[model samples]
Target: MRIRRVVLLMAVGAALAGCGADGEPIQPTMSANVGVGTSGTYGGVGVGLRRGGLGVYLGL
Candidate 1:
């Protein structure tokens, strides 16, 4: 699992490193996400938003 996560992160990093190579201006965009997880004794949900270079998150 650790190796897989490392590989996935490297792949994403490489992809993002190549973005905007054509000299195009960056555009503002808004996105929302939700995440949930649990362990042996606890779990929680998180909500998040990202706009351009800014981001926000809330967890419960």
Candidate 2:
């Protein structure tokens, strides 16, 4: 019986490990940028907001 309880607790812990503690978005972000300079240098930048429980993707 004690072993069963321990196994049950372990199973519960394992299940809970995959859940969010506060129930929020796993990932939310967006960004778009580009720059070109001399010597054929190129680069890009991006920005995003992650406050709500949603992941908004751009350029999809």
Candidate 3:
């Protein structure tokens, strides 16, 4: 059982390192973000905005 698990893990690792669809270049998405800064941050009651956008998902 342990050997089987090891083999399975190795196979998965190899698959991830290969020319999988997940390795394709993708675009960044934009969305609304609102939060507060912490830990010595200058911004207070942070009110930042971002443009809404879409992105691609290259799945394996």
Q: Can you give the TM-score per candidate against the true fold?
A: 0.35, 0.33, 0.32
Q: Comparing candidate 1 with candidate 3, which one achieves the higher TM-score?
A: 1
Which regions of candidate 2 fall more than 4 Å away from where they truly are?
21-60
**lDDT per residue (tens digit) for residues 38-60 in model 3:** 65433212111222342222211
What order do you get sorting by TM-score, best first?
Answer: 1, 2, 3
Task: Give the whole-model CA lDDT for all candidates, comma-separated.
Answer: 0.46, 0.45, 0.36
Write one digit per residue (lDDT tens) for candidate 1, span 1-60.
655654565455445435645754333232334555564354344334443675544444
**Candidate 3, position 9, lDDT:** 52
Q: Among these predicted structures, which one has the highest lDDT?
A: 1
User: Judged by TM-score relative to the true structure, which candidate is superior, 1 or 2?
Assistant: 1
lDDT of 2 by residue, 1-60 (tens): 655654565454444434544676344343545667776755443323343554333231
Deviation from native of the Cα of residue 24 in model 1, angstroms: 9.0
RMSD of 2: 16.2
Better of 1 and 2 by lDDT: 1
| Whole-model alpha-carbon lDDT for candidate 2 | 0.45
